[model samples]
Target: MKRNYNKPTQGGDVRPKKALGQHFLTDESIAARIADTLSSYKGLPVMEVGPGMGVLTKYLIASGHDVKVAEIDGESIDYLRYNYPELAGRILDADFLRLDLAAIYPDGQKFCVIGNYPYNISSQIFFHVLDYRDQVVCCSGMLQREVAERFAAAPGTKARGILSVLLQAWYDVEYLFTVDENVFNPPPKVKSGVIRMVRNGVTDLGCDERLFKSVVKTAFGQRRKTIRNSIRGMFPAGVPLPDDPLLSLRPEQLSVAQFIELTNLVGSSR
Candidate 1:
C-alpha cells in the first residue's frame, strides 16, 4: 500500500530508511505544538532539521516564520521541493550533521532550529548546536524522552551528565512535553519528548573553553567515582590533586558555575 505522507497510516509501512531514524509525525496537533516551541529568537530564519515529509514544516510556514529545511532523504527532498515551493532555494539537499552551518548563512548570522529530530543522531545534533552556539540562538525539537530529560536535567539529578553541564553553560534548556508513540506513522518503540533551548546570558565562561569541555567529560567519564578519582589522571604523577571541597562531590552534584571553577582549577594545576 502506498503511504500518503500527509495522513496517518493505519498499519502499512510509512517509514523512510530506518537507518535515518525516520518516523514521520502524522498528528496535526503534535506538529503544531512542535512548531510553537520556537518562541525565542524571532525574526531570524528558522531551519528545520530532518523535516521528514514536511509534517512540521507546513505549520512552521503557516506561522509566518521564514523557514528552510535540511533534509538528506532523496524522496523526502523531492516531496518537500514539490510541496513547499515557497522554499525555492532554501530547501537544503544536505545532511544537517555534516553541513558547514557557518558557511550557509551570512557571516555572524543567527537563526532558530526546530525539528522532529531523528532519534539516532539527536545527541550529535545538540553537540552540533553547541559547536555553532554563536549562530544558533534557539533550538527546539522532539527527541527520545530520556535524551530530552538529560538536556534539561539539573545538576545533582541522575539524568545530568556531560551534555547537561556543557549545554546548561550556554543555553536555558527546557523539556516542553511528551508525545505517545501512537501519534507517529510506523510508531517507534519509545515515547518522544519535545525540548527547547535558548542561549543564556553568559558571554564568557572565563576559562579555557576547551578545557571546560574536557573537565566536564572527564569528570563524568567515571560517573560512579568522585571528582577526585575521576580527574586524577588529568594531572601528572607528582602534581597533587586540588584540596577543594568539590573534589569530594560527584560530577552530577556540581552546577555550571562550579564546573567553571573546576575547569579553572584544573587549568592552574596543569
Candidate 2:
C-alpha cells in the first residue's frame, strides 16, 4: 500500500529536526527491504521505535502484523496517527526506553522489534531490548555502520568491547546489508546498516551475574592489561590467582566461554 505523506490535521507542518535525531527515511525500496527481513515472522506483535512518518510502519502493518509504535517526537506521532488511523490506539507517545516492555505482550507471547533507530540513542535501545529478552523474539534496527560492526564483531577485534561481551552473552547478532546516507531526507554523515539480533537464552556458567559483570568490566577496563592485572582487586586479598587457561590472555582475546570461566572462578573464590 502506498503511504499517505500529506500533513496531519492535528499537528502543523514539521520537518526533520536534528535536535530530535530525526532523519526521515525517504527510500521506499530500502524500507521494503528492511520490512522483508522481518517478514518471516508475521502475526507477531511488533514494537517499532522511532517510526518517523510511518515509512516502515506502513509496510509492517500491510504485512498482516499487529504493529505498535513508540515515538518520542510529538509531530511524528501525530503524523502517524493521522495517516494510519488503524494504528491510532497502538501508537504510544513515550520514550521507547521508558515504556514498560513486559506489558506490551500478553502472557507467554513474544514480540518482534523493528526500528530505524536514532543514531544517538541506538545503543541505549539495544540495552533496553536486552533487559527484556524474554518478551522479545528478535530485533531488526538501522544503526550506524560502525555500531553495527561492533555488534557483530568477533573476539580479538578492536570493535569488540563491553557491548559485544554483554550482548553476545544473551543474543546472536548479525550484520545485515548497509544503506547509503542519501536514503534519508536530511542525509547523515555516516552510512547506516541493518542489524538483526535473536535472543539465545542465557546459559548457566556457574557464576554470580554481579561478579560476572564485574569481572568482564574490570578485564576490559584496561584491554591491554592481562586478566590478573586488570582484575587484581576482584578477588579476596589472600586468594591466589586462578589457573584457568584464559588467565594469561588479554580481554580482547578471551571468548565468551573464557569470560564465563573467569567469572565462575571469581565467584567461587569469593
Badly placed stretches (over 4 Å) of model 1 are 1-15
* Residue range 43-129, candidate 1, lDDT tens digits: 888989998788899888888888989988877766776677888899888889898888887788998889999999999999988
Reference-based lDDT, each prediction: 0.88, 0.84
**Model 1 error, position 6 (Å):** 16
TM-score of each: 0.93, 0.91
Model 1 clashing-pair count:
0
Clashes of each: 0, 0
Deviation in Å, model 2, residue 175 alpha carbon = 0.4
lDDT score, candidate 1, position 159: 97
lDDT of 2 by residue, 1-270 (tens): 344556676324558889878888889999988887788789688999999888898899888888899987777876886789999689888999998888777575899999998999899999899878777888997988899888888888988877888788878888989999998878999999998888786655456777778888899899888888888788899889877667788888877888888888787787
Report lDDT (Cα) of residue 12, candidate 2.
41
Top TM-score prediction, candidate number: 1
